[model samples]
Target: MNNNNNSICNKSVHKKNVQHPLLINFGENQDGDGFDEFILDTFRFVGGRRYHNVSSSKYFLPNDLPEMDRLEKQHYLFLHIWRNNFSAPVREKIITKRKSSLHMAFEYPSAIFIGVDISPIFPSEQKKPDNATFLQNMLDGLPFEDDTFDFVYQRSLASAISEDQWKNDVIYELHRVTKPDGWIELMEPEFLFSKETDAPNCHKFSRALLGFLATLGINGFISSQLENILTSTKLFKNIHCEERSTPIGQWGGRLGEMMCNDYIESAEACKPALSQFIGISHEKFDSMLENIRMEINQNRLYYKTRRFYAQKA
Candidate 1:
């Protein structure tokens, strides 16, 4: 996919991928947490359809499973298939933007694709195979030469690495692998659960779910702390931050509608597995999904996306 003559890959030969191994960590926790099911269902719902990249304001290839870990790879695979199955507009949106990205990068050409995650399934190797590598170690303790990579990217990592030590490990690893002028970008969303009486999208449920998730060692509240963490570590320079509150179930627009639908389907797909492994009663899980749907339909609860990128000095 890197065959563009853009700024992101100019000096480099026009290749579809680079050799510097995109180290992506997989989250294989199919336990009671229901995360695996959610991921799978997400792919099943919108695997191929083009979605917005809130960061670049552009669309890139959407895969059911990205060329990362097992879970992600599965999703990118779904994405590839979905794209082929989508209507003309969705397909056009994706193709046009990806081409634009290639063009834009030709001018900017600094190495841009790198990913790292703390895998839960086999810590030994990445779930799937790609040009990427899987680290069997903790994120806080990376074993790499100093300044090894151009950029460090992470998303939805909180559930695997709790909040307290999350930032410490993340900062440490990002700092360790990043080149002198590299960037570290992180993306995480909050998990909200409404009270039984209020339904979905109620601030109360959102707060309660957020609080519950926090206690479980997930940093569902990492949105506000990203900038502070970067600043405190002094590991990054020229930090830029952006936040977007996406309504659940695509309530805000086409994208939001997609998001909302994806969440519900993902929740349902994993419900059986979640109940089997996590012991969450089916009733409760269904209730939660229903609540989420209600909120989206009512234009009540939404999620905020916080993205920040900084250069290593």
Candidate 2:
């Protein structure tokens, strides 16, 4: 929030001409390509825009940036640590059976990738590949029909929904849209960390952030309760959960460096809300974030991530 702080709040509205592997844009149809046309049509039919009216501020994170790149990096980081998109065995089934036509149309041999976000961060004019498609949508009420997808997964979306919505709407809708015996997974961070030695400023900022989120009806520790939430739904079976801890700075290697940057970005993204709710100044908030970064670079800090998955029965 500091004047010198990288304008993290500045929204990127212009579409960049640059192309990345993760950018998926399905442009108008060209002649003599029936299959590609069919796929694009299907993607359009299935992807809905029920939440288009919702403001991006409701998401509790900065969505005005090129999040596609951040998501691509985050996806690879998970793959690097877990070696797969999921820990549940149903992931293999979803990959092998090809039961979901929506999943197959985007990718011939590989699993189809479809992303929906409330922000217009993805490309909208370029010709997208068959492997993936991105849409603007909301999590609370997905536009898909009941039992439509083979695997339903939500990651780092804890801040997007309130506690009541998570309990009454988000979980139910995710379960409702998943096919019988399909899988639903949630991966989120607790946003709580520790350092080898006492770092008062960093701890103070972290606590303040957690408290701020709580006022919005978001549980900063929701990741730890994911297993219980899934089990209590009575709509899933074979529930499983896993946790991984990684260093934040040079001590954690290249991956750690990336994670450190991720943490910093998250903090910066939440600055506006923190400032408004906690009455903290932009300069003080920026200083606290810098101190946290310093702790990470000093190899004194580490954080944990939790992943939970279950099968819809």
Highest-lDDT candidate? 2
lDDT of 1 by residue, 38-68 (tens): 4543332333332222231111223222222
Candidate 1 lands at a TM-score of 0.55
Cα deviation at 177, candidate 2, in Å, is 0.7
Error of 1 at 186 (Å): 1.1
Highest TM-score: give the candidate number.
2
lDDT of 2 by residue, 1-313 (tens): 0000011123322221111111111111111122343343322221121112344234555433233345556656766766665555653444533222232333443545554555344443344445555544443355445665666666776665567666766777767656788777777876767664476666776788778878777787787887888888888899889988877778889999998887787677667777667687878888878988887787557778888878888
- Please report how far candidate 1 places residue 270 from its true position, in Å: 7.8
Q: List candidate 1 stretches off by more than 4 Å.
A: 1-131, 134-140, 192-208, 250-253, 265-280
Each candidate: what lDDT?
0.43, 0.57
